[model samples]
Target: MTAATQTPMLAARNLSCVRGTQTLFTDLSLQLDAGQWLYLQGENGAGKTSLLRILAGLALPAAGSVHWQAQPISNQRSEYHADMLYLGHHASLKEDLTLTENLRSLIAMDGLKVSDAAIQDALTRMGLAKRQHLPARVLSAGQKRRGLLVRLLLRPAKLWLLDEPFNALDANAIVDLQECLKAHLKDGGMIVLTSHQTPDLGSDTAGFVLSLSRGRA
Candidate 1:
């Protein structure tokens, strides 16, 4: 099939990861298409986070290759970085900077030009408008999480890689995040996240479940 006919926005072939003589997994393969979501389910130290880093091009897999839009990611590193967003366990925001400033820096790093008004709009959507001027270090845990989430709106990328996005979030914040994710998928963005809690999004939303134990068992 031609690249245009391939529905998957991201794909992995014979992917294997290893750390210090520990082989996390081998021959792991998956596909993520626009308007779809995938959940990485596993126990602690199951390499879920490592796999995500590899997919985001933050780290290299011990073997195999990753493809974005039918092109090998390694062949177009700069282009891949521009098209993917990866949020890990630690928020990338600067603790000393105000929420708005942190977001402004992030946008600048991505080499995108956005207006101040656009930044404010994204913060508002993530429920951080009222605290936009406050130092991110002083915000409550949930508010800090929301600050990180503002990236979703301020910058538009085709792929989202989230690791425990709901960490430190209250029930309401979790619900709000679920809504944001739903809207993202509806807009044809693909998501791959690792969460311990059951997802609030429904099963019909182009979902898949990958468990580390499946192959080991």
Candidate 2:
């Protein structure tokens, strides 16, 4: 690809992570260009979540670096964060707040202005429109997941870092979420996610896989 087309939205170089005494992975490198999707596969304790966090700039790597759009994330933290969204195992929603309230709060916290109509549109896209007035504490696992996913539509982020996004989702919800992700990628957005189950999103995008095992004692 030409230089104009060679720039990646996100890239990692020789990233090595250490959690306590455990070495998660070493010399890890990846490049996510626009409209691409990456699937991370590993055993339960293989540090997949840690890797995602590092890419999201939530945690620093023990060694090496992460770059967002050719700029070091360490130096351009705010700019990088402005263009990315990180959704972890915890949904980061207020249990006491209604679904709409939570979404509005998140958008405000991000310093982005979103209209109420847009918020409702996002909720409807995630299949949570009818329940938008209900507190998150009363929602089912899948509904809660849907409520969290509504952010994807409400905000404009170039990259999405999701950790086990399919958790607690039923088959139908899974399909719906897959479509949501597909639409994101189709719009030149990139995604990196870890999943125990395979993603059958029906897209022809290539994915890079990484696995980690304990070193010999």
- Which RMSD values do the candidates have, in order? 2.7, 2.7
Question: Which candidate gets the maximum lDDT versus the true structure?
Answer: 1
lDDT values of the candidates? 0.86, 0.84
Overall local distance difference test of candidate 2: 0.84
Give candidate 2 regions above 4 Å deviation. 1-6, 215-217
How well is each residue in 1-217 modelled by candidate 1, as lDDT tens digits? Answer: 1123454779988899888888889999888888888888899889889989999988999999999988999999989888899999887889999998998988998899999999999888777889999888899887888899888887888899999999989888788889889988988998999999868786657777888752341
Candidate 1 residues lying further than 4 Å off, grouped into runs, are 1-7, 214-217
Compose the digit string of candidate 2's lDDT tens values, residues 105-190. Answer: 99999999999999988788777888999989999988888788888888899899989999998988899889888878888888
Steric clash pairs (candidate 2): none
